[model samples]
Every structure is written in C-alpha cells, then in structure tokens.
Target: MLPQRVRLQYEASVLHPDSLIGCGVRRIPEGSTERYTRWINTITQDQLTTQVYTSHGPTVVMPTWFCSRNWFQRVGPFDEGGKGVPEDLLFFYQSLRRGGGVARVDHCLLVYRYHEKAATHSVLEETIWNLRVDFLQERVLSQWESFTIWNAGKQGRKLYRCLSPANQRKVKAFCDVDENKIQKGFYTYEESKERPKPKIPVLHYKEASSPFIICVKLDMTGGVLEENLNSLQLREGADYFHFN
Candidate 1:
C-alpha cells in the first residue's frame, strides 16, 4: 500500500470529480515491462487522451486509478466477465465516451508488481487489438476522409486489415523509411473479395500526407522514428494519432 502522504497527494491532485486520476508507478523487479512502464510514467497530460489508441492498453496504468464514487457509478460497474475480460480498459473507454477526463499525479504512488501468473496475462493481445481498433474507428477514424499509416511493416498492415471496409477505403498510403518497402510501391489487400484487390501506396515518410494513423512504436527506434516524425511539423492529435 502507498504511504499516507502519497494518498493525500493523489487526492489533492484531482483536477475534477470527472477525471480518472492515476499516478506514476515503479515496477517490481526493476526492469519488467520497461517500455510500458516508461510510457505510463512519461506521457504528457494531453497524451492521456491522444495516445489512447496505442497497444499499451491504457495511457494511465489501472492500478493507480482513483475517482469519485459518483463518477465511477456513471462510467462503470466494470465488466463482470471473469478471468480474460479487460475490465479496466473497458471501463476506461466507457469513461472517455461519457465525457470523463484523465489526469496523472506525476508521482510514483504505486509499486506495480509483474508476474507471469497475473490475471492480465489471461487477456489475449488480439482481444485488446480488436477493442482498440473499434474504439479508434468510432472516435477518430470516422472524422477523417483519408489518412496515411506511418509503417509499411507488420503492425501497419495488421491495422489496415483490421479496419472496417469503409475505414479501410480511407487509407491513402503506408509510409515507411524502409527503401525495400518503398520500392515495392504498394500493399495489396489480398483478403478482399472485390474483383480488383485494393492497393495502398507505400511512400517514403517525407512524401506522405497527413492526417496519419501512426502504427510505429515509439521509443523502440532509438529516436530515429521520432526524428522522422518530428520533421513533419504536424500536430499530434489532429495530424496524427499513434495506433501502435
């Protein structure tokens, strides 16, 4: 359990009753889930919403969450489905849909333990991927007429295949730094029943247009990917949203 002062700090930091308040966390055994831990502790305040579509599950780790009872009742009773259900993520998404906000206390208030037997491991990656795609389509993709995907690699192609037929039609290109993928020119949707397979152009990142659904994972590229993106000078939530 957190010390009294930490609890007080969290309570004091609440911006409003409607906010899903979380705090930074330190993982047990030091390096477990290193990238995920860094993401939870370091994302900017605005990224609490903007980065919601990423594979990280939730921008704020669920164990650190606190909220008013009134707000909780409004946004959730949580999914009662047993073991495999991602109740926290489901609740988080519902809260966002109901005009709730997210805020972090910016202090390490929890020691998040990682174990192979944890209930979280019961939840399948594909389950979360499908949920994320649905929410992204509902909240962000519906607003764009066309967009570029920031990777021409596995993750990017998976996102394209996962999108609904209507949203898939909105994909103008897949942009990448890989010369081979760029030289290949286009990605064909071989799964589609349409007589002419849908082909999406694969361009160098500099040649692609925004708004973009970036499928590239941040921090993993040793800043090369970030450098490429920053060069574009595009607004994050508006010009792009990270879906990795």
Candidate 2:
C-alpha cells in the first residue's frame, strides 16, 4: 500500500460493526512509471452508482470499495479471517453493526478478473448449508409455534435432519404429493433423543395445513410444485415460504 503507487486508500472503512469500504483503483499499465497519474485520471471521471440493502449490507464494485483515508481512520479495517471462514459475511456483519447501509452500484465500474483458483472456492457446500440453516432458524423458525414441511422426499427429510431439536418438535406434519409417502401414514425420526422415536404424520397438501416451510426447489419441480400451491389458493410469504 505505497502512498505514491496507490489510487484511493482508506484506513478502517468498516463502520465499527458496519464494514463499508470506499473503493478506487490504480490502473497501472504493466508496472509503468505513470501508474499513479493514470489512476488519478481514472479516479477523476468514474463515480460508480451503488445500491445499498439497509437490512443486509453494502456492496460496491466487486473489487473497488472506495472510502477516504481519514474516513477509514474512524470506520476501521476489514477482518481477514483466513481459510474456510467467510470473510465477506464477516465484513457485512460488522458493517451492519456500524449502521452502514447495504448497497450496490448497478453499473460495472471496475474490472473483475476471474481465474481458475480463487480463494472463495475453498468454502464447501456443507458450510453454506449450516449457515443457511442457522439463519433460517433465527429469522424465521423462532417466530413460529408450529409449521408443516412441504415435502416428504429426500430433500424435505434433509431439512428436517438439519433443524434444531426444539424446532423439530414444532413440525406438525409432512405434506407431499407422492402417493407412497402419504400412504406410509407417518415418518419415523429414528434419530430423535426422545424415548420413543417421533412419528410425524404425512398428509396430502390440501389435507395438511399451513404455514408451510416449502423445501421444494422452484425450477426443479417442473411447475408441479407451483401448480400445487396455486391449487390450494395459498399466498406466498404469509401462508408459506420457499426454503429451498
């Protein structure tokens, strides 16, 4: 971060809890002497339009977060949690803590270079799963007294397995279109801590009740799931929400 070589730099752009980064870049042409001058020229005319998600966090040009040095002196720096830890999420969390708004610029202001070996690829699918499960429970499941699971298939069962025990008890029933699962009458949770394994009833979508946490993915259903929801005359966000 040499001052002369740098284009725009911030100290700690994180808003204490909100890590909003002010972005700019030095378009140095293959290590040319005029690099800083070129960066200055590039900086003069380009103010990228950014949108913020207040509930979420700020997103600038993928690579160019532009906050001033003095401003960063107050806001702070990014958390560099290496390896599998999600650094972007960590920053977003900190940003929200600092009361910085989440936003993004619609226009492509910076060049995002792609390569075969990016650090982001180090994260596994299961890590994302655990995070999503935790978030869903916090933001949604905690609000409900009870709810129905939309499918009785493998995916639905997988979601059931991932739920917290207290949340698991709140599952009223499993709703499905498959005749075999419905005819099975109930699903046995063989892995439960209770003395007797929990046997959850299976019901037809119309016969079962809401509010449903639909585990079915939209496009994969080939419109069948959509049709079924529509047939029941249920509303989204209120009656049910898509978890998949």
Candidate 2 displacement at residue 18 in angstroms: 9.4
**Model 1: residues >4 Å from true position, as ranges?**
4-14
Best by lDDT: 1
lDDT, model 1, position 118? 94
TM-score for each of the candidates: 0.96, 0.61
Per-residue C-alpha lDDT of model 1 across residues 63-166, encoded as one tens digit per residue: 88888888899996989999999999999999999998888887777889999999999999999999999999999999999999999999999999999999
lDDT, candidate 1, residue 190? 97
Q: In model 2, which regions exceed 4 Å deviation?
A: 1-79, 90-116
Which 10 residues in a row give candidate 2 its minimum summed lDDT? 47-56
Model 2's alpha-carbon lDDT is 0.61
